[model samples]
Target: MSKRKKSTTAFKKANKFIPGGVNSPARAFSAVEMDPIFIEKGEGAYLYDIDGNQYLEYVNSWGPMILGYNPPQVIEELEKQLQLGTSFGAPTEVETEIAELITEFYPAVDKVRMVNSGTEATMSAIRLARGYTGRDKIVKLEGCYHGHGDSLLVDAGSGLATLGIKGSPGVTENTARETIVAPYNDQKAVAEIFNKYGSEIAGIILEPVTGNMGVIAPQRGYLEFLREITYKNGSLLIFDEVMTGFRLSRGGAQELYAIEPDLSTFGKIIGGGMPVGAYAGKKEIMDYVAPLGPVYQAGTLSGNPMAMQAGLTTLKALKKEDVYLELEKKGQKLEAGIKKNIEELNFPAYFNRVGSMFTLFFTDKEVQNYQDVKECDLDLFAAYFKEMINQGIYLPPSQFEANFISLALTDSDLDKTITANYKALNKLKAEL
Candidate 1:
């Protein structure tokens, strides 16, 4: 371990050019009450910071590095494509190949369109939905972050919650009006909205299992209710599976829950860590996009070959092994260990988990929605985050984000983390 003098100096210089010294708000570390640590490299389960400190990385680049940083399979395929070309601004075989793989896994995704990011995916999906349904409004839930797409940011979680911003400026009042926000996990509220605006709603979009609001799972029968009501109302059901896709299961949240959505948006693991996103749906609906139909969208780097190669390689590797089971076992181990610590220490914390994603909330109550998540003691979470960093462990810098568990984590890594967590809880308890 070493001091973060170099990181401090780098962030100071970065602040001169980049806004808040980070490319993304989540990386700003504002919520954690500290300057961000710049990573020199990530190999296997560890991240090495510029200051020469090693951390057992838990963020996993916010859920994309499921195979851990620099997995040989992905890098090898990327190297093969690197020699061929980067981007052609034209069609490539790898793009079709990756899309085909996704289609085979998800019955809801008979066709898909590649895009630059999750924001683009959700944005395009919304446009397509409106065009297809001939409707003017969209429904989104509280705390389910689709992306920075203007229509989807009204009550977003993650960065907005971390920064305490209600919604971004520059978004038109008309755009906000077009979006109807509802409380998550409350089927009654969703049904009431549908009962009133059913005919006007183009679609209802939400994360089937949210990571943005720190890994809140859908209540039993919740997904089915959305699927049924949307169908009955002639409205599209859109699953914002950007974070849960491929990470939760081979077929994503839809397969895990056995519910089919009219449209599904994906990112993160699908790109194998490269910048990529996609929106897909049944052939009848996806045909509404672009050249096939009226709703237009375009991107030069939409299906970059390198990203396709990386995504294909990663997805193929997942198919060859019991990756999901392995991840689940690791997740279960970590959860049990932490829960045991909480019970013994009598800590006032609530833990929520779904597969490899989890959050240790600072609130004592069960966190079912954003209102409950707000009850969390942010100041205590900040102190715990800093303590974990001091102990050579890295976590998501905000209580609003979920921490990842990767396949690269060894038993020793889990052991160390458990011990570190126990010590952190006990130490924080003493200080109280």
Candidate 2:
């Protein structure tokens, strides 16, 4: 037994101050059985843990590290901003500049409200949708997690028409009832829900490509169908693009699918690893927020200078046409390599990828929804995860999470990652 493997002692020490030794549940490594490695620092496509172990990172801070950790341009911008000031409750031109850049990419986004995090962006968007439509209920797709907002923390119940359950304990049943659950990629089911409660439904929210449930893409025509149905029913469609926004394409999943959502929430690559998020849509709808209409939303730290500088720098750097094309090429190459390795090992693994986001499920079945993903062999994934950690490849420590590749990774880095995956799979099989 390795002494280094038993890092739980540090966690035990940490639980007194931090709940479960982590602010986020997934970071606790609950789904994959291993003590969380306290990362000391990260640079480019690598992370150094407190134990002095360096890893080629595929998680990339859960899709936010697009330029990888500590990109020179982002750092330079931050340094300049640090010398100026941090948070000024007053407006800064940088905020408007970043907003302008975002609006340029998303043609449908007429106005944007900057927020502190993805949760804030999603929560505010839902409120705006409800206020604009004068409705009480929202339609949400199963497994498409927008954030920890009260209305969003709902779980699917027994039947298609059944009311949802409070997914988390603290969320009240009343809050759960406000959100309706529908199966993903099922246009008929969505239509049925709207038909039944069309007048009372405010909006339909979904991840155009669900990264939270293992990078499941929308079926062909699925996105178009959603737009058409919601429009017919007089309900808005909200795209929670926190993961896919800048990573999938410069304009996000809407660009990839050619479907426009009335409203969209953005995070991840927007902040260049800094804490930032935004919700944007048509002017008529967004005007419902405070200072214009009744729906209230305010943030003391929203559009803070640090976040704006980091996001603008990252976005400017990504504007180079070659960067995106290079990313797509690298992603496809890695996907092919992973598929070959899976087949060669005769492993019961399924691969999913879109652009730089990927997932390797520990099951033979095709993963398309929460139900399909629930059948995954999480125990096998845990074993594989541990093996990968030992092999110096850092994967997301959950079976139902997406892996992100960064522009920082070179061909050599990609090859190294694949080789490590092969060794990890072999090691896992021997253990079995």
Candidate 3:
């Protein structure tokens, strides 16, 4: 590890032109009470910063690099596409091929439309839901974070949670009014909402296994109840798998949990680290979008050739390899080590894990919902973040986000992380 002199200097220069010296608020590292480090490049399981420091990174580009940085297969395809050219702004064969792969992997999706980011996928999906169902009101679980779209941002987790914003100011009262917010895993709240507004609600959207509120899993019978309730209410069920897609399993959280949603939005691994996103569902609902139906949506950079090539190559590799099995072993190993650390240190915080996604909350109380997650010790987490980073381990700066494990990580990397975590926690204990 080295001093962050270069990153500090860069931030000072950038502040003159950029708001807060960063494009995204999370990148500002405000949640950790620190300035962001400028990364030079990523290779294997590590990130190289501008200050000549290397970190065994756990953020994994916010859950996109499931195979880690610069996988050879994805790189090769990107290079091939580079020679062919970049964006054509028209239909491409590679686009259809990649869309076919998504439909094949997801049992609920018969058609899909590619977009530039997860926000676009989610925003369009909601519009399609309202258009097809002919209803205006939509229901979303608090802290699920479908995206920054006007209707879905209320009580959104992750970025908004990190910055301590309740909701964006510019959203109009009428738009916010249409979005009915409910706490995740609270079946009674959802049931009661349905009782009052079942017929008027356009759709119910949630994360099958939430990553935004630090990897909270749904309670027993919670998912089953949601599926049944939406079915009875004549409302579409949408799964925002922007974080879980192609990371949890072959078919994402839906396959792992055996609950298929009416519409599923994807990002992360499907883009193979490129800028891409997709929204898919049954043919009837998907056809409700664009040329085939009345609803309209288009993007100039949609299905860029390079993105399709990278995503297709990555998906093919995932299908051929024992990726999920390896991830499970890796996840279990890290979980056991961290649990041991907590026990030895006599820190009774709750840990949540769903496959390779996990979070170590700085609270003794269990975190099953947004309210519980908010009860965590923010000061302690901020201190822990400093300790871990100083030890050359890169973790998400905020407690609201999940730490990911990629296939490129070896057992040595896991051991180093465990050791660093123990040392960090030990230091915190001493400070206490």
Of the candidates shown, which would achieve the greatest lDDT relative to the real structure? 1
By lDDT: ranked, best first? 1, 3, 2
Count the clashes in each prediction: 0, 0, 0
Off by over 4 Å in 2: 1-9, 156-166
The list of candidate 3 runs beyond 4 A from truth reads none
| Deviation of model 1 at 425, angstroms | 0.9
lDDT of 2 at 301: 94
Which ten-residue region of model 3 has the weakest summed lDDT?
A: 343-352
Q: Write the per-residue lDDT of candidate 1 for residues 1-432, one digit (tens) a residue.
A: 578999999999999999999999999999988999999999999999998899998999898999999999899988888898998999998899999999998988899899989999999999999999999899999998989989888989999999999999999999999999999999999989988988899999999998898989999999999999999999999999889999889999999999999999999998999999999999999898879988899998999998988888888888966789999999999999999999999999999999999999998899999999988999999989988999999999999998999999998999999999999989899987
Residue 86 deviation, candidate 3, in Å?
A: 0.4
* Clashes by residue pair, model 1: none
User: What root-mean-square deviation over C-alphas does model 2 reach?
Assistant: 3.2
TM-score of each: 0.99, 0.96, 0.99
Write candidate 3's Cα lDDT for 1-432 as tens digits. 679999999999989899999987778899889889999999999999999899999999999998999999899989999998999998999999989999898999999999999999999999999999999999999998987899988999999999999899988899999999999999999999999999999899999999988999988888889989999999999999999999999899999899999999999888899999999999999999989999899999999999889889988888967789999999999999999999999884678999999999999988999999999998999999999999999999999999999999999999999999899999998887
Cα deviation of 94, candidate 1, in Å: 0.5
For candidate 1, the C-alpha RMSD (Å) to the true structure equals 0.8
Query: What clash count does candidate 1 reach?
Result: 0
